[model samples]
Structures are given as C-alpha cells and as structure tokens.
Target: MLFVEAKWLYNDALTFMNDHDINDYDSKTLTVHVLDKDRQPVTHELRYLSSQMRQSVIQGIKNNMKSLATLRKHDRKTGSLKYKSEYLSINLQQSGVTYKFYDKRHIRIQGFKKGIRIEGTNQFWNIPSLEFANAKLLNLPDGYYIAITTYQTKRSEERKYKPSIGIDMGIKTTITVSDGRKVKVLVEESERLKKCQRLIARRKKGSNNRYKAGKLLRRAYQKLGSKKRDAANKIVHELLEHERLYMQDENISGWHKGLFGRTVQHSVLGLVKAKLMKNERVTVLPKSAPTTKYCPHCGKLKKDITLFDRVYECTCGYREDRDIHAARNMILLSGLSTCGTQEINAFGEDVRHWQNSAVQPR
Candidate 1:
C-alpha cells in the first residue's frame, strides 16, 4: 500500500512539474490524480503515505532535475521525467523519525502498524562505533528490503598490504594479475532460472498466471545477480589486498556486441571494474594508453600484435605471456616518461628498466 501510494504521488508530481515549478507543489496532501480504465482523470486519496514519505517523492523529482541539468551542461542529451507505473524505492530521510531498528532482526518503518522482521541485519549487528543514517525501502520481486546506510570511525590500526600489482581483464581468462594469478570468471544461469524464463514466456499475457510467472522470473534473475555480486566482491577484496593496483580502461560492454557476447554476458567483468575503480589505491590508465602494444623490456612499441597472439614476442629478444605482458606494462609503461622514476638508456632515450621492482609472473 505504501509503494502504491508512492507511485501515485510521484506520477502526480511529474505531471504537475511539466508546467509548474516544483517548489509550488505541496507534499502534505494525500490526494493525488490517477487515470481510470476509461482513460479519464480521477481524484484518488492516499491512505498509507506519511508526510515525510510524500516529501521524499517530490524530492526525488528535484534530484532528477539537478542530474538532468548537470548532464545538459556537459552537452549530453537529456529528457523530461516520465511517469512511473510502479515505484520501487522510497527514501526514509531521518533515522528514528521515519524508520527505526527495534533489534538486529526487527525494524519499524513509517506508515506501518507492526514491526517487520528482517533477516540480513546480522551482517552489521555488533560493529563498534557504527552509526545508522538514512535508509531506503526497496520493493523487489522476492520481498521488501530496507537498505540502511551506516558509518564507522576510522580505525587507528593499519592493515598489512602486499606489493603493488597490475591487472588485465580478458574473455577466456576473466582476470590476469601481473603476479600470474589468472582468475577465470563466469557464472552460468541456474536450471531453475531457465525453467522460470520458459514458464513466463508460455503464460498468457495480462493473466494472473502470467503475473506469477513474471514474479518467478524476476526472482531467478535476482539470484543470478547475487551470485555475480558475490564473485565481484571477493575478487575486488583480493585485489585491494595489494598496496596499489594499476589497470587500463577497457570497454567490457563493447565486447558484448561482438563475437563473444555470451562469454562476456556470463562474466562479472563489469562489476569488478566498477568496484575496483571506486578505490583510491587503484590507478586506471586511459584507454588510449598502449598497455598491450608497448614492450616493457625493449622500450619499443610492438604494433604487429593481434588478437590471436597469446604470447608477446619482441624482436629485441624479450618474450612473455600476452595478458601477463600487458599486465606488466600497466605498472611499468603508464606515464613513466613524466614520473621521476623514469630510466634513461646510454643514448639518453627514455626506457622502462624497472622489471626487478615489479612482481614476476610465475
């Protein structure tokens, strides 16, 4: 009922904002406009949406407006907000005022009469110095979820970190580290997911059975998403154990349209890239950088390398694994000319000669 009312309020605000300023819209009103089966407008009153939740709906529009304006300022194409048929999330802006946690397993949200039992609270239950902030109520196919934002003070103790390394993302071997750790990543869809998809496709459209089938399909996809996220999390955590990480900005999505679409789709390369890019310890070289083309040992560009070349062989008598070689260049070739650690040959030319400083691939 809360989410249904939220969708009504959001659509009403979007319609009103098309001609009027958002500031003039009232948030305390439970009355909203809806279209009936005859495509006629009718006044509907909300029963479960509190004033705070109502205000959040309007605030979402304001945030979208700012986002669109920012995109336009950067010369990106933009569009007006569209009306939502179903709202999936609602911001509970104030802790204790809008929502409260009764215990590790129970929580209370505004406009609800009873406290809801939640299962995932044990993940962060007894953390020291943890502070809860604003949370979002999420409506998913499986069930309702409350995503709470929490903060913890910085610990004085520093964690031990390994030596710096570079990474190379690929198709067959999902991730190849400079230290010779090649992680093959692929999570195939489960048999249940395929069955759910087939069931949904055969059901009659607009029927209750179709809706139930659709729900089952969505839940299956959710499970698949969870597996990908867990894999990405583990890989990111392991990579972050190093003191620093260097990687090139490769277009993983572009591969999805190419010959290896199925392979790319099943891999979690996109998720790994996103999570790793967020860390301060990670250094992302520009796409224009010749991470694969540059020869680290001979200090020369090997322009003849192709997709079929699994091993990088240079005429200067240096050879290495293709992905490992590229991974090594990530650490050695990136901006070496500008940094103070650059080495000079006898001819006074810039050369990359710090191979001993990097991790040797086994």
Candidate 2:
C-alpha cells in the first residue's frame, strides 16, 4: 500500500508539473486523483503518503527540472521529465526521525504500523562511532534494500609502496600492466541466464507467466552485474596500490560497433576503466597520444601499424609485445610530460640510454 500510494503521488505530481507553469506549484493546495486498474479516475485523499514523503516526491520533480535547466545552460539538448510507471525508491529524509533502527535486525519507517525485520544490519551493529544519515529504500528485483549513508572518523594506516605502473585496456586481455602482467576479467553468460532468457522469449505477452519469466531474467542480469562489479573492485584496488597509474582514454564505446563488440562487453573493460579513472593517482592520456604507434626505445612514431600487429617492431630495433609497449609508453610519457600533451615526441626516450642514465646519474 505504501509503495502503490507513493507511485500514485509521484505520477500525480509529474502530471501537475507538466500541465502548469513552474511558478505555480503549491504543496498546500495540490491534490492528487487516484486511478483504478480500469484506467478510470477515482476520488481519493493523500492518506497513505506522509506529508514528508509527498514533499519529497514534489522536490524530486523540481530537482529534475533544475537539472534540465542546467543542461540547457551549457548549450546541450534537454528534455522534459517523463512520468514514472513505477516508483522503486523512497527518500528517508532523516535517519532517526523518518526511520529508526528498532533493534539489530529490525527497523521502523514513517507511516508504517509494524517494525520491519531486516537482515543486513549485522555489518554495522557493533560499530560505536558510526553515525547514520539520510538513506534510500530501494525496491530491487530480488528484494528490498536500504542504502544508508554513514559517517565515521578516518583510521590512519600504513600502506606498502610499490613502483608506479601504466595500464593498457584491451578486448583480448582486459588489462596489460607496464610490468608485464596481464589480467583478464571475463564473466561469461551462465547456463542459467541463457535458460532464463529462452524461457522469457517463449512466454506470451501481458500474461502472469510472462511476468514471472521477466523476474527470472532480471535476476540473471543482476547476478551478471554483481560479478562484473566484484571483478572491477578487485582490479582497481590492485592498481591503486602503486604510487601512480598511467592510462590512455581509449574509445571503449566505439569498440561496440566493431567485430569484437561482444568480447569487449563481456570482458567488462569499460567498468574497469571507469573505476580506475576515478582515483586521484591515475593519470589519463588523450585518445590521440599514439601510445601504440610510438616506439618507446627510439622515439619514432610508426604510422603503418595495424590491429593485426601483435608485436610492436620499430625500425630502431626496439621490439616488444604491442600492448606492453603501449603500456610502457604511458609511464614514460606521463613521467616526462603532463597529461594531454599533444606532440608524440614531446617526452620520447631511448630505452637503453635512459636505463643507463638511471643506473648511473651524473
């Protein structure tokens, strides 16, 4: 009843916003008419949704309008907010006031008569210094979840320092590190997922059986997403252990139109790249840096190298694996020149002389 009423409030608010000017929204006088399953309007009062929840829904609409205005200010195309067919999230504006922890395994939310039992409270139960803030109640395909924002004092810890490394993201191998390490993270579709998809396709549309199949399909996709997230987190954590990371902002999106699109998607390269890019220690080079074309040993850019060239062989007798060579260039270039440097030879190095000089600096 709570979620159903919340959805009705949200759709009603959205309809009101669309019909009237922005300056005409009034919370005191705004009333919503409920609709039955037959698509007929019926008279009803906003009895289920609390005053705070109603305000939150209206505020959400205003926030979307503000976002659209900001996009238009930046000369980008914008569109109006669409009415939501379902409302899966509700904002708990205050932690202890709107919602409160009844005990270690139960919670009480506003407008609800009974305390709801929850399962995931054990992780934060014994923490003394934890402070809870606003949270969102999420109705997912699997079950209901509450994402809480918490704050605590930072604990200082010593970290093991390792040499800086550069990474090259690819479809063949997910990541090629400058230190000759290749990590492949590919989560192939499981048999269960395929079976679920096939079952969903065979169901008739608008039937209860079809709805059940859709749920199973959603669960399968959710499982795949969890695997990708876990892999990405582990990879990013390992990369951040280094002092610095250098990578190029390759066009992973454009790879979707190529022959290896499925391979790239399944390997989760985009997720890894996104996670790494968020870290302060990671330096991203421009797309035109020519990390693959330039020879790190002789500082020469070879223009004829194609994707088929697995080995990067330069005219100056420098040879290495294509991806590793590119990864090494990322470190060398970033060490000499700042990110976004345009010239290919701006910080080119002769590998032999550079190593000798490093070994015996004058």
Candidate 3:
C-alpha cells in the first residue's frame, strides 16, 4: 500500500476573492471524510470540517513533518537516515481512499481520477505495500510536491505452527508473555523534546518563541508516538501468528499514576492493549485478575511482592522472572473469566465494578 495525502484540492477553493469584503477563506468552509478501500467511513467526526478545523488539521500534518525531521536527524546511521528525508507523507483525516504506485509514472491518488506525478530522482526501496499504495503527493505547507516512499506488508509465507500466547503489559518493559517470555522494548527519551520543553518552559507564556517551542515539543512527542506505534505493530504481529493467546486485565493506568510517572506515562502498553483486544485468537483475562499477585499452580497470593523485585519468588517454592510468571498466569486466567470481566468486576452485576474511566482496556 502507498502512503498518499489528499491536499491542495481544497486549497484553491479556500482562497478568498480579493474584491469580496468577507474573508472567503474563513467563510467558505468544507469538510472531508475518509473512505475505505471500498469507500466506507472509518471515522465518525473526522470527516470534512470547516476551514478553521482544517487549519487545526494541518497542525497534525505539521506534527508529522516535525517528527519525520527529528527522526531523520537523530536516527541516521552511516550518513543515511533510517526513514528517508526526501518525502514527507501523511494521511489526511479523509475516509474512502486507496492508491497504487507504478514503476514508469506518477502516483495515482484514489477517488480523484488523475495521478500526481512523482517528485525528484530519488529511488524506490522495494517494499511489499508499494504494489497497492505508493507515495504520491510530497506535501509542504506552501504547495504540493511529489513524494517517493517504501511500503511494507506481511509476507505470503504459510504458517507451520499453531501456538498462541497472551500478554500482560507493563510500563518498565513492553510486555510479559504467558509462556515465560518478557519482551522489553526500549524507548530512549527524546532529547529534542527535552530541549524544546526546557526552552518553552523558560520563555514568557505568550511569546512567539515560546509558541514555536511548544510546537517543536509537540512534534517531538508525535515522533515518539509514531516510533512506539511501529514497535507495537511489529510485536503484535508476532504475537498474533500463534494459534491462541491469553492476556491479562492489566493495571496500566495505575502505573501511570505512580513513580517513574513520566517515563511510563505515554507507554506502548496502550497500543499493545488495543492490538490484543482486536485479535480474534486472543482470549482476554479480566483486568482485576491478580496475575502479578496470584500464584499460577497453588493459587496463593503473594501480597508482599514489590515492583522493584524483577523475579517472582513465592513461599511455595515458585520461582520465575516476575514478568514471565505474570504472562503465564495471564494464559491460565483467561480460561476462568467472562470476556471482559476482571476479578475486580466479578461481583454482582448490579454493583457495576467497572468505574467510569477512559482506560484503553485489554
């Protein structure tokens, strides 16, 4: 699949007439909806919005551009960036869209009939998704440009095994699998974000420089988020290839409230939680189940265990790495609970154990 952006089509329409007394750019607002490959809406409110909303929408694009630029600067190796700097690609909130890339010519943005020609002489790195979606519109704030990019999708190889696994997510590490495996994906704190944040913090509240710093910091955060999302996707794909999986009702939010607060605040656990919940083969254990506190074999509760203790050593001679033990317990617990019910919510139906919260549950 190609990475294509829908831009400029509405820019001319948004321009104001010089003779008109009214601000045409502000008055003539339009909203655009995203259509799927089959032209169905994927989002509810993200469809075409007013020009003000569109300007705000461009902030998201600006965020993406800033992030790409930061990644290009810091993630470069051997004098080359990990992600190419030649093309700045983004997905506008518009719905119903699909695209294709060809070797000889320009990128064809779906929905619109004509293809936007490719920009520059940059080479295409062979990636799978290029067949359906190639980078078409290299976008900048001033005007539309052509972009060349790579696309990658899962390979066509057939699966030979039927094993599946469930996970317990945590802040210090990425995930704790039920099979005694701990996948610790590390994220280095963004130095650029820190610098921007510090600069913004030191400036006067409403100054232009302060505003610029805020934008830069926000971009740093956006880049950090993208990196995390890519990592989560790769890990989730690996977990899903298995035949079955058992996952826990984890306390990701509680972790965010405690010490190491900022470090784990915007953790990948949220993305992992989302990915596992959507998978058909994954069976979820109730969030209240004490995967960390309860023993898998003897059903004993180790109330004294602390977060600093990396290993789970119980009085019953049960010894395992803390995350691994929790992961295995997740698989075991998945079989005993209702689809979304956790032990905390296992009380009478009238009690309503689930609190009103915005948690991204697993």
The C-alpha lDDT values of all candidates are: 0.81, 0.76, 0.55
For residue 132, what is the lDDT in candidate 1?
90
- TM-scores of the models, in the order given: 0.79, 0.79, 0.53
lDDT of 3 by residue, 60-87 (tens): 4445546766777886532311222122
Looking at candidate 3, the ten consecutive residues that score lowest on lDDT are 349-358
After TM-score superposition, the amount by which residue 302's alpha carbon in candidate 2 deviates from its true location, in angstroms, is 5.3
By lDDT, who's the top model here?
1
**Would you list the rank order by lDDT, best first?**
1, 2, 3
- Score residue 288 of candidate 1 by CA lDDT: 63
**What are the C-alpha RMSDs, in order, of all predicted structures?**
5.5, 6.3, 15.0
Model 1's lDDT to the true fold? 0.81
Q: Candidate 3 — what's its lDDT? A: 0.55
**Model 3 compared with the native: what TM-score?**
0.53
Any residue pairs clashing in model 2, and if so which? none
Give the per-residue lDDT digits (tens) of candidate 2, residues 142-205. 8888899998878778877688887998647468998888998787888989999999899999
Evaluated at residue 273, the lDDT of candidate 3 is: 73
Q: List ranges where model 1 is wrong by over 4 Å.
A: 13-26, 37-44, 62-78, 204-208, 285-305, 312-320, 334-362
**Candidate 2: residue 201 Cα off by (Å):** 2.7
